[model samples]
Target: MPQPATGPTEANTFPALCAHTHLFPGARCRLQGLSDPHAFTAAPWSIGVDLRFSDDAAAAAELRTGGPDGPVLAVPPYTTGAGTRIGERAWFVREFTWVDGEVELRIGGHA
Candidate 1:
């Protein structure tokens, strides 16, 4: 059986585990809610998820099958596109975007 992924999202965690059962967080790793929609963050590889909520913060995982799955983004990429106009509650992100020296992913929704 595949063990539930533990610890942060950095690649370092797995390599150490295989060597000496040791794990540590990585520079790009973090913990988040599974099904909270806002809990999901887009990794380089796309992960299957149902229901994305307000904002592009993090995503939450859903145990059951229903609704729609979330799309993979560049963590906090800009949502600007040709003819792009977001509703009052639309979400988007841009690479290398940050505020107060911390990264921020835009979160919003459509009317």
Candidate 2:
């Protein structure tokens, strides 16, 4: 049987984890779980990858557009920081919230 998905929570603050990847290079990872959650001792698990954002154009656009009340995302110090498309739930986590500020992607376990 398939287990339920893990929702966002104080511990699961996805944005902060992304920030880790932002601050430190190649820290964040994407997890595509197996359909059988019940088969595992714990919640089912699968493979993941340490990721870095690549949204140069979009980062600039976000800064230009600015949200309701904020300065917008600051430019990343390195090339891997900015890009037009950071992720794609169509292929990956496409529905995550927009993270404007610098953060560290804190993966569970190894933190």
* TM-scores, each model vs. reference: 0.18, 0.20
Off by over 4 Å in 1: 1-96
- Which candidate ranks first by lDDT, i.e. highest? 2
Point out the worst 10-residue segment of candidate 1 by lDDT. Answer: 13-22
Count of backbone clashes, every candidate in sequence: 21, 17
lDDT of 2 by residue, 1-111 (tens): 343453211122122223342422233422223233233224222222233343322111111112233222233233333332333221111112212332222222211
What is the per-residue lDDT of model 1 for residues 9-107, given as tens digits with 9 covering 90 to 100? 523211000111111121122222332222222232233222222233222221111114432222222232233333222122222222333223322
Which 10 residues in a row give candidate 2 its minimum summed lDDT? 57-66
Cα misplacement distance, residue 93 of candidate 1 (Å): 5.6
